[model samples]
Target: DVKVTQSSRYLVKRTGEKVFLECVQDMDHENMFWYRQDPGLGLRLIYFSYDVKMKEKGDIPEGYSVSREKKERFSLILESASTNQTSMYLCASTLPAGLAGAETQYFGPGTRLLVL
Candidate 1:
């Protein structure tokens, strides 16, 4: 099965603190992405990597960054967690050929994060 696993199912943090969220996919897919989902805003991309050691900023990359040292793993780092950063974080991966950058993506269950 194609599975993406996140380091946390839930997280609580204080303002101005650094946070790290790790994700790993067992399928060895070439592309991985990090996104944040809010109540009414839908899913917003934070960062994405198409290959190892390569990264790109997404729509909402202001307070976040990403890393992909290995093909199967990616990490999202919150430089300083803030109240506005509190949301459901999702990690996803897709095959390179068909849907890597297409309209569809396979997502993790998600991590609910709250910043105080």
Candidate 2:
């Protein structure tokens, strides 16, 4: 089974503090993603890495950054935590396109961050 694990289930940080959320997958998936979800706005991608050392900014990448130094681990960085940055962050991984079940994404439980 492909298992995705997150470093934390909840986090609290003061404004201007730096935070990091880590994610790891047991499977060797080529695509990994970070997303933040809100009540009405739904899920918004923050950043994603398609391959080791390759990354792309997502729609709402202004306050977040990502690192994928290894095939199984991906990390999301919050440079300066703010009240508005508090949300449920999700990490996902999937097989590359053209493979069976490639469209299916395996997601971590998520990290709920609260910036006070």
Off by over 4 Å in 1: 99-104
Question: Taking the tens digit of each residue's C-alpha lDDT, what string does model 1 give over 58-80?
Answer: 99999898889899999999999
Q: Quote model 1's TM-score.
A: 0.93
Q: Each candidate's TM vs. the true structure?
A: 0.93, 0.95
Tell me the tens digit of each residue's lDDT in model 2 across 61-92.
99888888999999999999999999999999
lDDT of 2 at 2: 86
Model 2 TM-score on a 0 to 1 scale: 0.95
State the number of backbone clashes in model 1.
Answer: 0
